[model samples]
Target: MTLTAAQTVAALATIAGSDNVVGDPAKMGAWLYEPRKRFHQSAAAVVTPPTVEAVQAVLRWANENGTGIIAQGGNTGLVGAQVPLSGNEVILSLARLDRIRSIDTAAGVMTAEAGVILENAHKAAEAEGSMFPLWLASQGSARIGGVLSSNAGGVNVLAYGNARELTMGVEAVLADGRLYRGLNALKKDNTGYDLKDLLVGAEGTLGIITAASLKIYPLPEDYETALVNIASPEAALELFQLMRQRAGARLNAFELIPWIGLDIQMRHGMLDRDPTASASPWYALIELSRMAGTAPGALQSSLEAAFDAALISDATIAESLADRTRMWAFREQMSECQSREGASIKHDVSVPIAAVPALIGQGVTAAETLVPGIRPVPFGHMGDGNIHFNFSMPVGADPKAFMAEFDEAVHAVIYDVVLKLGGSVSAEHGIGQLKVDLLRQVKDPVALDMMRAIKTALDPKGILNPGKMLRSVP
Candidate 1:
């Protein structure tokens, strides 16, 4: 028989304590409330494990009882993976397990516990004379485990790669409560299977990540940032090629921003002053890392080339740290500013680098067709081809009613364009319960079969983040 919410709470309290297990719905706000506010399911209990051993004990009990369990970290995920879906699942929060276990500057590795905040990880690396490159706006709350599990990519992914690439190894507890000790700092390991790769982006469905050994890099001396005025995505893409050819690895970030983003931010007073170089149809927020012994003006020289090529009309290079901060604030605040404007439908999708223009061009046209006067806000990593393709509701439209009317219809149209251009619906964010159906529909049948088989082999009981990523049992 299935355990009641009361019984589950009692069981979890026994494993940890009454203090650690929160069954009261009112008190479970921190663990339940996600960033998007789309998922509001109540969990059976929120169990905060004080130690790795405590986490293991709770999992063992849940596994034996056939109870569902969801591993939660900082709970800052855009997707609903960190929160409970079925409401029957007990949330195994790793918040108390946060710690910077070790940092090897010479070896360029940092082993952080699952619940360590991403910002804290950065501090630890900086203290050791290195840097962890996985940066996001939610770094204040997003944890190491969740970041690795989701395989998050931020602006710097153009240079350092995403979470999966930066992660050297992981320590996770399988569904059956066996700890897989895979935290080794080996650069090259051609062992049996790529288990680390599978668990990194598995969205906590296959295993519960307890700790990770992340790749660290030498801190750049300074960064040369610019907000360049471009006519369109096509121009932005051309400018990106010029920068890649000129700056190479020093080209840390090359993001595309639309005029709509500037209009929204300025109208709402989200920024103290305009950060761009006057006004144009679009903008590209570009940054180049200046390593020790490297000269500056790499960004300036590249912009000159872009200007000569007629790809960019005007540009503003950040002369001071404050200038750089303001430029980045404009980029980072893109998602939050949309909320202030009212309801917005967002797609975190990606295509090949060359196909970004086509994706944006066709995607905007398609969304406008669905909802006349719909505002398209296509912006993000242009170099990596991941655009946070979002659409704000028509001005003064009822937010709830607009979403109710066109959410699914808009998705169908946008996703159709993404697939036709050889793009993915989910780029940075993983398929939490949000995209499971879409994944099943768009993914190759054989690839889906392989994913299901692997999930079954690793988590036979379907307890680790049940019903996430994979839709059904193999």
Candidate 2:
């Protein structure tokens, strides 16, 4: 039988102390409010489990009582994966499980609890003279559990990889309250089904991640950063290939930003001063990491070659640490700068690196056709072909009206083009409640069936993050 709200709270309080159970809605704001502010639903109760055993006990009770448990971390996800969907579900907050279990710099691995903040993980690695390469804008608040759950990809993905690739192993609690002690720093294991892979990007649909063994890297001596002027996306793509050919693995970041980003930032006083070299139609923020023995001037040499080929018009190499920080700030602020304009429609889509120019050109044309005078601000990891396809409403247009009329229609248009080019509709962001219908519409029927089968087999009671990723079987 399904438990009532009172019974659920009482049971959770019994498992993980009364002080840890938040039954009052007013006190649940911090866990309720997501980063995007798009999803708004009340949870039955927010329970913070202080230990892994507490988490297991809560799950055991939830499974037996048919209660929905939504695993939440720092609550910084853009999608609603960490938030509640149905009002009856209980939110299992992992905030109290913060701990850096161990750091083995010699082995290039760090084992950290799910509740450890991303920034704190970075500090721990740095303290050992190593580095956890996963870097995101929300690193200050985004916890390791949510990061690994979503398999987050940030700017450094070009050099290092996404969270899935960076993670070596994970220890998660299964739906039936059994502990899967799969944590190991093993570099290579001819393991059976690769359960770690399943849980890393599962978004808590399968199990609750307790801790993870993450791959860390030696600290780079320094980074050579620059902002180059490119005429268009096509030129930026060519420049990326050239940098890769020249610098190889040292080419850490190659980000694309349209001139509109600079304009919006300056208009809103988001930047102290312009970080680019004169005016240009587009900019590519490129960086190369230098090791201790490696020589500098690699970026300058590459830029000279780029200039020789006319792949770039002009560029400004960062002269100091302040300059490098400002250049990255411009790229990082791309998402935030859009709100200053008005309501914006956003898509995190990806296509082949060679087909990026076509994706942007055709996408922009289609968006303009749908809404006349729509301002297109397409920018992101050009090296990886994942562009943050976004469009601001026309000047003087009503934000609410624009979104009401064009949100769904605009998404349809963009996804059509993305699929046509063999791209993904949701690149970095996983399918939460927001894109459930979209996944149903675009995902392969066979793949959907497999996902549903897996969901059912793992979470037979549907008590673990119900109504997320795959729809409920029933």
Candidate 3:
């Protein structure tokens, strides 16, 4: 028989501890709501297991009882992956497991508990004279477990990598409560199946990550930062190629921003001053890592070369720490400044690095065709081909009416262009409850079959994150 909400809470509290279980619905908002506020499902209860063994116990009990468990960290996920699908599920929060198990600077790895906050991990690595390079806006609250679960990518992905590439291995509790202790600092262990990759992006359907061995790198001595004005995305692409050729691995970041981003931020007083050289159609916030004893002004000289090649029009190279921070502030505040204007339809999609120009041109044209006067705010990691293609509703249009009418149709139009260009529908952001139906519509049938088979093989009971990523087989 199925247990009621009270019974489920009581059982979980007994297994873990009454003090760790939150049965009251009023207090479960933090775990239930996601960053976007798109999903608002109520969880049956929230359980914060203090130890790995406790997590295992909770999972075993959940599996046997056929209860759905949504493993969560920090609760700062953009997609609804870390939140509840059905109201009957229990949120298995990993917040209490925050700990750095070990840090081997010589090996360039840190074994951190799943609940270790991303910023804290950075501090720990910095304390050891190394750096964990995964830098996200939500790093202050986002945790290791959720970051790896989503395989998050950030601005630094150009120099470092996304969470999966940086992760060495993971220690997790399978749906059946058996611990999969695969954590290691080894660079090469061609063992069976490469299970760590499977779990890292699984969104906790296959397992609940308890700890992970993450690759850390030597700290760069300084960063040469600049904001260059570009004529268009085409020019931006050429400039990006020039940077890669010039800086090679030292090329840290290449972000593309439309002139509207600057206009919006300045209009809303988000920036102290314009960070670019002058008003241009587009901008590129570029940076290069300067190691110890390396010559400075590499980025400045690069801009000079770009000018000679006619890839850029004007530029403002950061002269001090404050200038670099302000330039980055302009790029980072692009998303929030849009909210100040009005509701915007956003897609975290990616295309080939070369086809970025075509993608933006074609996408903007299509969006305008559908909703005339819609403002296109296309920007993101130009180096990595991930553009956060977004559209601000027509000026003075009702935000709710605009989203209600165009959200679905706009997504269809954009996804069509993305697929035609051999691009991905979802890039940095993983498909959570938001894109379940979309994934089914766009994903290959054979890939879906394999995913379902793996889900069944690992979670035969279908008790882990039900109705997420892939729908119920039956």
- Give Cα-based local distance difference scores for all models: 0.91, 0.93, 0.93
Q: Taking the tens digit of each residue's C-alpha lDDT, what string does model 2 give over 238-297?
A: 999999999999998899999999999999999999999989999999999898899999
* lDDT for predicted candidate 1 compared with the true structure: 0.91
TM per model? 0.98, 0.99, 0.99
Weakest ten-residue segment in model 2 by summed lDDT? 465-474
Model 3 lDDT per residue over 1-474, tens place: 788999999999999999999999999888887877899989889999999999999999998999999999999887799888879999999999999999999999999999999999999999998999998888899999999999999999999989999999999999999999899988989877899999998999889999999999998999999999899999999999999999999998999999999999999999998888899999999999999889898998888999999999899989999999999999888888899988999999999999999999999999999999999999999999999999999999999999999999999899999999999988988988888999998899999999999999999989989988987854
* Model 3 misplaced regions, further than 4 Å: none
lDDT of 1 by residue, 1-474 (tens): 899999999888998999999999888899998989889889999998888888888888988998989888899888899898888888888888899999998899999999999999999999887999989999999999899999999988999999999999999988877889999999989988878999998888888999999999999889899999999899888888989998888989998999989998999999999998799999999998899998888888888888889999999999999999999999999998999889999999999999999998898888998899899998999999999999999999999999999999999999999999999999999899899899999999999999889988887888888888886686
Clashing pairs in 3: none
Model 1, TM vs. native: 0.98
Worst 10 residues of 3 by lDDT: 465-474
Displacement of residue 408 (Cα, Å) in model 1 is: 1.1
**Worst 10 contiguous positions by lDDT, candidate 1:** 465-474
